[model samples]
Target: MNDMKELRILADACFSAQVGQALKRFNASHPEIQAVVSIAGAKDCLQQLKTGDVYDLAILADSGVAAAMMPDHTDGYYVFAGNSMVLAYAPGKILNAKNWREKLSDPKVSISHLEPNAHSVGYAALMACMLADSVAPGMSCTLLNHPGRKVVAADAEVTDYAFAYRTECIAKKISYASLPDTMDLSNPAFNAHYSTAKHDLTGDGKNIVQASAISHAVTIPLAAKEPEAARDFIEIFLEHNFTAQGFQPRSEIVGKSPRRIHAALEVRKPPRVQSANYEDEADVHLLQRARLLHRQQPAAEAG
Candidate 1:
């Protein structure tokens, strides 16, 4: 590999800015390697990869990775970062956090969400809404009619609220309410609860089941033009970039023959549960309602 070669990365839009910033710093320090990043929705990014669009590295949500894995497009992959869904809003627009559920239920307050199938955040948003509705029946219905839009656009507007990533809200300096672990889909302890809510994609009738947590997975594709550079970037990224940007970094490496390891590494399976005992009576009720709802209607019709 040449010392001055450039590396191309295709990443999900949610964290691309932060990733670009990290790569800029890496480029400055290393001088020999320059990296450029392209950001898009998770679905779009994965589709590009599937169609033989060349990139040295790819970063996307776990769901997207799952899709990529099916086609053997990934040489290796690992969970690098974790994030949770939140309700982002402009300052002073909604008062009284205690009445958030009521506010969301009120038809007077307009809400925005992302397309459920196109993006992980969108799918998580639907799960969050369904979780909210389970706590108080009919809460999800209020958001059902709300049109889906990009999170960036939603953040810029002064709408009542929009479903978004907590890290994104923080990075963009937007006011947001952190949802509970059970609803946010960011805690492994709530896997049982999270799995209860599900929604179907718009085009395909495939149901998007909620995972225990929202994670960012990075992979080096088999046909990468600069595999060595991709490995170097991953090493620098996992060691320094992710934690600085408010992501919970994983210490383990995954997939067959992971790239350079700066420290002792282990290949661990995705977390199925967390030790935290955060579930309360309300959580129990929420899960109960979710299971009941799932049984009551088909996923396609429910969506």
Candidate 2:
């Protein structure tokens, strides 16, 4: 554990840059630990974890998908952070509508979302639309298909609107419409309501992904070459502030509890930020409960 090591990570594309930045800082502080991050679609990351021993850790935004894919790959995963879905439009667009739902219902307006089959954010956007339709009829608008968030952001000027993460809009300086709590898949408190909306991953009506609050999960694979380094990186990651980056800390959702106490350390100055054990039994249970609607293959088929 003392020897210099390299910790490889596969991360969800939507927030991969932020993760890479966090790990880069970790590497700067600890020269002995070299962090390598590779970005890919959430499903691709899981598929790689399933097939090879290349990555020490995998971080994905969709906890349900990760849990469904991580049966025998690792011990378990920790929910580290969460993000909200937002409607990003070009800067000069005039908005006289009451809310995002109203603006979306217009057939004249064109929109874009990541290809539903290739990315979790795409499916999330689809589910968001379905939920919006249920509450307010006639939210039926055609969505332009894009391969990734960057493409969607790039085409935002030409396309009337695009569904993207709040973080993406903030980082790219695109104007976005903040959704209501009922429609924004950000708060864990609205998990039940969100579950009512779902998207079929496979066109055959099987393998469906239900709408749930967006929370990111990180896990150290059993095949990790540097498990200790991966754990250290995760510890540093959770303590770092991502609020400016548009991520809501897991501590605010379910990580903090009265029964938990800060580690006993004799020092005049307290730690800059108290770290939360994201793998705590109660916190894991709560996260699992929130993701009741998930796509899981049968054991016989999964193997």
Candidate 3:
């Protein structure tokens, strides 16, 4: 037991389960390293870090990493992957096509969303609703009052629909409507348009601006108990796990004084494969569903 190296990680719920499974596979190859991973909302993860709890590594949304960096809590930060927002619903509970927006606005339709002030997904959901309202005028107010609930809980509680990650819906095998670039927070081209939409969490008129894309960021905290092991784990993750799990790996680095590491941050683009690549089969299916749902629908449709 003395020879084992313990590495602790705190990450947002979207990435935690998959990452924990990946770490289990990693441990199989390196028997000397033991990794413990905890997944929660971005705010909860950040709160744990701020309260003096030591974690070797942290995987959070861009905003959470920025919060940690402000106080010099992290040694460096790296952009690892990206995700987009979607509206998930039980199969057949909600229609997939043209009437989706109308369905959400219906008083009888039970809608749920994460807490906007606590999770990145929640913030993105709020932004998506705001964007929808831009074209429809009242859509934002309807969604803002959606009962706050975790995605999993909402699913079990029979929520008609909820805002969620495109990848997450696919991962959970749920039917979802793929949101458009303007409302999904996936396209950087819509950054200015997205910036125009904001929501006040405190209900006191202070607006919290949302980013256009959901980029996953990682960092090694200065208070880490085993920094080198944490760094090694990140290298393994980047080299072997991310792409396989359907995330678009970022090539560029973003952070304040990022620590130099042996791992190459940039993943080389692979040659395009023509055949049915199982690695991205789920992603392709989700996109196709999104297209089918949005085809011929008005721009004001809920995503």
lDDT winner between candidates 2 and 3? 3
Instruction: Show how many residue pairs clash in every candidate, following the order shown.
Output: 0, 0, 0
Please report, in order, the local distance difference test score of every candidate based on alpha carbons.
0.65, 0.64, 0.65
| Residue 249 Cα positional deviation in candidate 2, in Å, after optimal superposition | 2.9
Cα-based lDDT at residue 63, candidate 2: 77
Score candidate 2 by TM-score against the native. Answer: 0.72
Task: Kindly list the per-residue Cα lDDT of model 3 for residues 1-303, writing each as its tens digit.
Answer: 387777898877777666766697778877777888887776677667777888988877654344445456874577767777777776567444345667776777777677776777877887788776543557677766644434444335667777877667666667776555656776565576677776554456533444556677778888888877777777666655555554555644555433456354666453322211112334544553365346425756654
What lDDT tens digits, residue by residue, belong to model 2 across residues 110-180? 77777776688878887776665333445433222222223343333457778777777767776676555
Clashing pairs in 1: none
Segments of candidate 2 deviating more than 4 angstroms: 1-5, 96-99, 140-157, 202-207, 252-303
| Model 3 residue 14 CA deviation in Å | 1.4
